[model samples]
Target: MEALSEVKLGPCRDSPYLRPLRIHYTQNGTRKHWDFMQTHDSVSILIFNTTRQSFVLVKQFRPAVYMCECARRGIMPTVDTASKDCSPQSLVAGELLPASAGVTYELCAGIVDKSDLSLQEIAKEEVLEECGYNVSVGNLQKITSYRPRWLQQEGTEAYRRGTNRHTPTVCAGEPSAADYWAAGGECRGHRRS
Candidate 1:
């Protein structure tokens, strides 16, 4: 968990989601570079809608996910033939998403800022704020605390774009940003292979 470098690109003009102020500066020897710039903070949740046996997932148009092949690799589930009615490709290709395939679903997650709040507390708050759910701190599972896909704004779409034939129906909260669309909408451009 070492920060290699950070670069701030500067403020955005008409971003309805974020306020522009600071840019990231990356460590490059004695000089920090601007190419590694990034957002100040972000958060996401892996909410399980217990009643539906479905995970609460978010969707948005991600330029970065489109830029990288992450959209393809991230949602690709490994095969387990012992189980019936599911395979990685089938899970990916199915009209409906399984609990596992929904893992890559992205939402508007923010970085913890206030000094008074602990990360766990912040995580609980974010889940409530983003999804309108009241979850206990004990119920929250602390997954890996790292930004493996800091750049993947919409990588979830990759496994999803051409396969919305049976995607789950999501009960979404008010979207934090334009990228945040409901989990499944009437298919617009999902093309099957």
Candidate 2:
């Protein structure tokens, strides 16, 4: 269910998701500046399927991952670095990166942008929307929270839940469990003990 096509790159001047920021500060009397993006906090749910003895994950194409893979493979185009003209045509006719290059397996996650919903509520909604599991907010066990230095914003509070319900169903435009399993990996940082 992951297909990325007609790829293009452009400068982002405004976005509802993130804001570019530069902070100037003095560390040990040395002036320093760091550029980062300010974004909403997020939550990730590790859906453990007790019946299957495996974890249920989400698989989707990440453009950032694709671009990084292309760059690493030395196949990315170098034209119009600051503009939106970077498209498939910018590279050799057959140089497009494979769709799988961008694919990633991750926990069901969503941003904490709704003001009226509590963190657990948002997590519950994400589980239903992304993973098609109707898990109650009370069943979500908080594991930990940590902010990634690169994002420079509030961290994601991780949760885990064990479910023996029927196989997960896919919401519209969401990846199916087959794709998730095909992507193949355990939930990072969490292992069966």
Best by lDDT: 2
Model 1 spans with C-alpha error above 4 angstroms? 1-35, 59-105, 147-193
lDDT per residue, candidate 1, 34-107, as tens digits? Answer: 22222334445566555555556544333343323323555333545445554224323332222233233465
**lDDT of every model, 2 decimals:** 0.40, 0.59
Against the true structure, what is every candidate's RMSD?
18.1, 11.0
TM-score of each: 0.38, 0.65
Residue-level lDDT tens digits of model 2 in 70-102: 889897766554565553335444677777888
Instruction: Show pairs that collide, candidate 2.
Output: none
Clashes of each: 19, 0
List candidate 2 stretches off by more than 4 Å: 26-32, 79-93, 148-193
lDDT, residue 79, candidate 1: 48
| Window of ten residues with lowest summed lDDT in model 2 | 158-167
